[model samples]
Target: MSFTLPTPTAAERNRLARLFAQIASDAGTRVMEVYESNFETRTKADYSPVSDADERAEEVILARLEQDLPGIPVLAEERASREGVGGQIWDAFILVDPVDGTKEFIQRKGDFTVNIALICGGYTVAGAVFAPARREMYLGGGAAEVFEGFLPGETVTQGQKLVTRAYPPEGLTAITSASHLDERTKAFLAARKIAGQTAIGSSLKFCWVAAGKADVYPRWGPTMEWDTAAGHAVLNAAGGVVTQPDGAPFVYGKGGEGFRNGPFIAWGREPV
Candidate 1:
């Protein structure tokens, strides 16, 4: 017997977006609780940092997801690295980064976020990202339109619609990582004649670009699928594009490649 994936109806997609917003918000609250306390931090095997907030927030997210959407496989950052996700030919699955900026969280910077994305057919169908510290959340993809605001307890219908701005003729405004800026990134900006650059943390860069607050985000460093999926969905819905340096569409479900993402550029508007 062969198994098949069920396609989500429009109503289901809208409902799923709301559920994802709630779940990501719940995870963000857990992170914020740890952020306010004397939390312990440690280095992972990959030399990247992980804090109590990361683990605890993921726990909260996984628990709720399991309860609310049973049988759906979840590829979460901490859990997937610890216990490998089984090789199931899933047509739909959840990708989550419970705490996307552990370093920023540890440093008391309000730039960390909680991310939840639903990938089906190798594309992000629905997603929600919450920055509890900033009281901002972004939701989009699938049947939902891109939107952002105080969205933890609110639905997409209540949030403000987001759209990308036109590319300015003077130069481009770029957002980059606050802690992980590499020379390649600097060179990319220099070559593009960037008008300005802002250093930020987590998937907020993608959200800012989606909301027309910024013009572009160029990432030259390595990243995981969970690190960008949710934001990618939001940006994609907001009239933006995330593509490789060669202008190929950024895609997901690269389990064969260890779910690693190559360098990509997210554009607020099509660039010449």
Candidate 2:
């Protein structure tokens, strides 16, 4: 079934979309500002790279969301591990990844983005992905928008309507993390004999699939809910599936345990 964002009226949907787009754009600005600056990169405890942009972008996104849509739970990457915030057992809430491609941003590749997803019940009702460095914004799936803006933060006029491509003949083209590829994914690929592959950073992996650029993404390495939530929502709206290997739906409220996601695959349709 096609997914849809929950909104009382077209006006309300448009209003929320505009606000979400702006918040994404602002977060993009904060990220780019740090991108332009000479910031030192540090390895996290797990050896994944992080920068000032990551923290700043989360701050910007969270601050605006709190002001703009208070009372709704916010499950942010940075705050997800904190004592009182990460365990989001909300009937409705926002899931955000402030700076999705920290590695690409650090490498100056400009493939990063600000990802936001709104969840209703246990599913992604709507999602927005803004790739600032590229000056493109992709929305819809459960909710429909494709837009390009002239300036870094100009108005996002709509573009082509996007949908996930049909599944591939020789199995799907899968995208994986640049830094976190692990044995489980390798084994899955080997056992499945999936040949085509691409490596990407941040939530753009999900955006790629949502935009019909790729068909699958399998992550076997460590990931928190925030790391996948926004992208998961985007994929979900785009006629895709993001599920635990056990065949259970990936639910939130995992608590402040930080890394929680095991291996999961996202695809245009359910993979055989």
Candidate 3:
């Protein structure tokens, strides 16, 4: 028999956001442990890099999720790599990327992050992202207002509410992937009057726009649902919108396509 999971209430969503932040932060600690050491890296079947940091961090997140939310299905990177996530349409589930920017982590660029997001009805309902090396954490969804915090130590410092900035009269500033910029993305930007552009690693591109540090992030390259979900949730909560190149909705849970994501543009505010 098939069962659909119910969406969390507003208060429950806020609690889950807090829980997810802590989970991501805890996993980030494991990630930092490997980052500080002489870590060994290996390539996955898909040719993407994976490291001890990724495995260790994923272990932390999986353990916590199993303890707290046992019934909900989890689609995590490391585990999914080992055992393919068979075709199943879930009404609600968790997406976890123990280390979102593995390349950055391997290169010691300090832009990698631990991501965890709750997806309900093919939409991100709550999420958390923790960049351990950068000492920053962001959380949003449901009743909880989008906010960012610093984690120089064990606990997160006070969180400051976040809101996407209005599109400036000046030309737009775009954030693109440092490692994955492609011809299509270049052409997309070329067609616009952009004031500046910044290339960085990981889902932080979405957070950049969410924090109003940049105006838009357009990606024509490939991505996984897990790679974008948490950042998408945070951006959505911050008054931003992520949609297709033509401004259609971008929904998740594409099991048939192996959970891959197509090109999408993230805007701080929809252009008038």
As for candidate 3, its clashing pairs are none
The whole-model C-alpha lDDT of candidate 2 against the native structure comes to: 0.71
Q: What ordering of candidates by lDDT runs from best to worst?
A: 3, 1, 2
Expressed as tens digits, the lDDT of each residue in 74-180 for candidate 1 is 99999886876554456888999999987888889889899998888777767888888888888775433444346344433456677888987788889998877
Q: Tell me the tens digit of each residue's lDDT in model 2 across 224-257.
A: 6666766666676567788777777876545545
The alpha-carbon deviation from the true structure for residue 254 of candidate 2, after best TM-score superposition, in angstroms, is 2.1
Per-residue lDDT tens digits for candidate 3, residues 128-183, read: 88888998788777532433445523554336787899888888999999988899
Instruction: Tell me the lDDT of model 2 at 11.
Output: 47
By lDDT, the better pick of 1 and 2 is 1
Q: Give residue 139's lDDT in candidate 2 (0 to 100).
A: 68
Which numbered prediction scores highest in lDDT against the true structure? 3
Which parts of model 3 have CA positions greater than 4 angstroms off?
1-6, 143-149, 156-158
On lDDT, the stronger of 2 and 3 is 3
Q: What TM-score does prediction 3 earn?
A: 0.93
